[model samples]
Target: MSINFEALDLRAFLAVAEAGSFRAAADALALSQPALSRRIQRLEGLVGGPLLERTTRRVALTALGRELMPLVRRLLDEADSGLFGLRGAAGRGARVTLACVPTAAFYFLPAVIARFTEQLPEVRFRILDLSATEGLDAVSRGEADFGINFLGASDAAVSFDPLLEDPFVLACRRDHPLAAQARVDWADLQPYRLVTVGRESGNRILLETALARENVRMRWFYEVTHLSTSLGLVEAGLGVSVLPRLATPQGEHPIIVTRPITPRVTRTIGIVARRGRPLAPAAQRFRELLIETWADKVLADKVSVDRPRP
Candidate 1:
């Protein structure tokens, strides 16, 4: 006798096996308890074996069900993968979910997206703006296809590809005493109140490490989360800040000015993904676009200087 097991039946079987009761599985699957029971019965009949042992108060999977669990999971995963592959082959386009640090979303992603969309208009993008740490977690959990964050050694389950080296710069009001100087030293900044991104940020860690080496004790007047807010506070003369040069807004923001910090500090921005996983075609294309755009547009115009230089 030929037997056919539908996707819905397999899903119902898995739900029932996991939940241990038709009522619980029904709630989980959003189906009626009777409907779920029927699906499991149909599944067991198709397999020519009893899949579960049921009593008044409980349910438990039989030996055959226990043995089939792994195969069922693999079948589900493979089915989804096969469907995705077919979609790509048919040119239906693929969706990529990208998680990124807020600064990258504010500064780097716009240009890269403009170039990417120009080439692959059919593809869609879902962007998650997260903190550096959170973005890294999202990629590792497979919640996102890939992520862009500060370059640092991540969990062994994750891998990174360096994209750009962005330097930290001092930002102050235009009429501030240090604004007119070519560059300002760490000592000169000590006298002023400092506004900066919060300590949780990777940028903050880099700044703190540099200051620690020099034994500098700078006063922080404000520790804000957003780059734009930090710049706003500086423009209002509340304090000066060290921010990534890339994150500096292009247009004039009242009296705000950005100047290179004399003893240069820099951070590497990179792409991160699951260590052993293959990227979907759309995600791979987007990654390539980001690298190409950074090289052709952003990096080409920069003055080459050794990093962490004084």
Candidate 2:
């Protein structure tokens, strides 16, 4: 046997593996269901064992399938980067769309975008600075190639690669009475009027769920839609806000300061991509850069935070 398999065969396998649904993978690739099945079958036969365990309700990768996934991704990545798989050199200067929550978009993305454009100068970017829920929808619907989000870790349609744990912290003016404490408790915030997002916001939901167990009732003095708005209100001495550490000012602000609030409520921030879809070469490269850059930075920040005081 020549042992030859086309790129499409590998792609078919990759799609179904990511999707966990033959129909979804087929639709993504614009192939008929039976045709997609035949492709998967042909690829499986060439590989010398059953790659996928498929039934009516679910489709999962077998042991061999798990082992082969990285190899398949690498092969496809190489093809997409070059002119062979793409439609000529036009793809060399493509637009990469990314969805991110507002805070991440503002604080994290500028550095990554600067680093990415240094190498791929012609590559453009479309940043969808959406809310957490909207960001997940963008990536799932393929509007964005990827997202930096704190939600979607459990979403069935997307894969989440966690980058960091962003803890909720108390944001208040430096002169506030609670700011004198090294760390504040939920009960301590009871007397002060709280600035918070609406009930429907993901952050609010995560917060309310956690605080419920502690019987910590917050007094909402002002409710804003965006985290930034809450911060702005805090800066103006309106009210204190509890928000993710990432959303807080990093260094000494003239008025605002952040302190860890107990019990800690943290969100796992990560990269989210649609299951079973392939990113374009430019998008793929940018995603890789973003992960590498942020992962190392977060690890360094963690180590510094963990280092004992003198």
Candidate 3:
């Protein structure tokens, strides 16, 4: 004869074994007394012996039941732990973790994140506001599911997907001479003392590389650690600054204005992920949202720039 048992049988037996009375066990398990009895009977049948000794007012375990008690308790304990572990893993997956450059985090990513979260109210986000190189490292080191940053030299462990080209633009005080022009060339900036980000910044490296290739040079009178800080300097009539178009203030800042530069140079931003690794469902969904929204924004920017201004 073969012996078989189900989780329900073990659970019922454990509940009855621990509660000390059928009525108490039935109440605890949220089952009728008769149903609880039936479950114990099924387990007893498989065991081929009486497991519980029932009296008019109390219940006691047989010798066989005592032997099986510890084993059944261990099995149930392990099962519960495994189920809880799986639940924890699922909870972690419900949130998307993305590493993004400060430029994207400031101007491009927030709107897309708002739209993505609206459709997934249960989903959450952990945004790592890192620099281009740091963002790349986050994804490559498995600290983030994906990253949005410039197309820099990446390791063999990661792959890149081009997203958008953010061109460098000139930012100046509203009443400055360059603000009235439709566009100013790099050569046109020669006369101005420029406020630029420090050499430590990836933006500075990009500017240096592009300028070296174009064979252009400019005098940098003030250096700041952050692009936003450069804007303040420009606003105070210190000097003009060249920064990514995305870094420019979006709304009308009466003290500041931005203009495109001739012989435009752009930094290509992209998505970075560990090679051959798949994104969690939430991360993949957010990635799709980023791509779609980016397309709309690029088109809109082009249309706005092409429109004739009064």
Candidate 4:
């Protein structure tokens, strides 16, 4: 049979059942005797059985009430335990840890981290800056809460949530022949020496994978393992490097500029967390903030590029 008693009713019944004196129970519950009686009466109505035998001097539990007492106590105990766990899990002093590729760690996450820390001053972060492959491994192995990386090969151990599409751009010195153009094609960049990341880099893999789909390949005169090195080479008039628009600095650079590649190629960046596993409250909050920050960045970049030039 289904019972409709509230927790308050259960508590009130338990209080009176234990004390065996309505007056004493009332005092313990900080309730008037009549109010306590009313609560027991409501509980009886829902339980469809009288739970207490009350008299002028003594109170006792009926057989049904005695049978239910242990069950009620266990329920209360479990409820308290659950609430205690929830409170501790979301506490302000908790540490949030996650992983992401170096490119994201460098260009995207710092601003998001600054804003998140402002909201949760006591929260600590253990941000693992690794390659996309390593980031995925960290989350899968439970070493990290989650990761951010370009969308590529599926994994049964991890899940991805696409946040934004980062397009490849041509990074070149301001004085380069094609730097003045708003956009340049892959073929246009072929005439000049090209700098690219090493094959070990996830960025390089993503670029090569994209180019292979179109049956296109470019000769790389200079190959570097770091984006900073690629930028340095571009600044020194070595050659232009193709990179995600997000990798380039937001504002004007005195010597180097990034122009979008024509027939725009892009990579999908997203969140990767362990399959069927939920993140801690702090990690979840940081994930939401990252999404909001990315959305703001996308809008701001669109406005900056679309606004009328003076």
Candidate 5:
């Protein structure tokens, strides 16, 4: 049967079912008992079924009532979510929470954030520096609006969209022998002590997997938490480390040289958001800014100038 339902009446039904008495439901709904009873009666007439088995002492759902309750609850929940989403969209000036890998924060996020601030001065940002796994978790848990992480071929409860691919480079002291080479292979790295990021880091994992494929091994001198720390160790001639090209600071350091690794390896960086969930307006605006900045400043410049004029 075709039935038109009012949200207020549905709310009344839910309250009666939960409170188990018309008086209690009316009190909870902030309506008189007679008004509440009239709402329930109107709803029951529309559905053409006795929803609740009511008596002088108690109230309980009939078989049809039990069947209809779940659908009514779902309808109310969807309506509430829709209203909340619309309100959030209307309040476009709200702050956005973004989580990202530390390296992305250091090397990639700054320029995007600067551009975003210039355009959307009224918008606020809350940034969290987390590892790839932690960043993914934050997005999945609804703690972050979006996350920047290293992309890989794995199925998780979040949606990932590749933004850029940054190649790996070998960083070492300027005086080190390998620094002078035009290009170095994995085997050439075997002699030097490696000051690497922790194995759990996405960068380290990619590097290790590539090295394993080539059957190349190096002496592990140290493991550090931050890329800057590893760069510092490499600059001090403590060891050489493989780092993303973007993470390598520009200009000459007193003791550091950066070189491309032959048979180049790269990591995919991407934007991650909760799967099957809509993004808030602020978050969507921030994401657009991120992509625009990356495309214009980072990816566009990195393209080869020698390629046939396209």
Candidate 6:
């Protein structure tokens, strides 16, 4: 169904959501309380549901409103950024939002953000550090301007620009038996306790499928929801973990070391953005900077391998 609503209506909803009171929202929007109510009513009608639940004291977002907040924020932000032919863009917030897998966010974004901030100190960032599936969702739905993700190269809705080929490696404490080896084979891990992420994780699925093809099966002695958790377990000497090399700390960690595993399993880390979508000027600049930052012969050569990522 085609639905049309004015920007003022969205502003009315946002003001109420933020203030949690229609009176305060109306005051902030410079509209009479009744006027604000009508705009909200009109918006609710168009949406076919109430966006808020109003009590005498405060207002709360409905389930649908909770889900709509990110998309709405993005729409208003884009409009403010001169994406919708609206003027008065001087009022734009100058904020850039990107969804990223926690691993990539931890590994890459700090340096990239630091560099971007050096150039554009006035700009701000909102990072949605989600999983691969969630990151892809955010980029595809425009809730994020783009994403740093390991999935979505074949997805038609977004463009995935490869940054590196991150192979799965064995993560263990420096004192662990496997750490003595220059490199470990998948069979080498069979004798040790294995720490892994939960099966629901995208990385787990990818790794499991790839290892199965190599006739290597992993049995998890401990399963956690995050790769970082697995790494923590490994560092504590509970068991070793199999994870992307990028998920490990760069350089040396006093307790932890990663060993290359053969035959290799890899994931392609990259930038993901909605196809044909033009990012706001600041976002476009940051995206370019991120690509340029990773465009290094040394870094690429270090991660590049013959293994095909799932």
Cα lDDT listed for each candidate: 0.80, 0.86, 0.83, 0.81, 0.81, 0.86
Q: Superposing all C-alpha atoms, what RMSD in Å does each candidate have to the true structure?
A: 16.8, 17.0, 11.1, 9.2, 14.9, 18.1
**For every model shown, what is its TM-score relative to the native structure?**
0.65, 0.68, 0.65, 0.69, 0.64, 0.66
For model 6, residues 5-60, the per-residue Cα lDDT tens digits are 89999999999999999989999999999999999999999888989987788689
RMSD of 1: 16.8
> What TM-score does candidate 6 reach?
0.66
lDDT for 292 (candidate 3): 85
- Evaluate model 1: give its lDDT: 0.80
Candidate 1 displacement at residue 1 in angstroms: 39
Counted clashes in each candidate structure: 0, 0, 0, 0, 0, 0
lDDT, candidate 4, 109-171, per-residue tens:
888989988887778988898877778878889999888887433665677766667889999
Pairs that clash in candidate 1: none
| Residue pair clashes in candidate 4 | none
* Regions more than 4 Å wrong, model 4: 1-85, 151-153, 292-310
Clashing pairs in 2: none
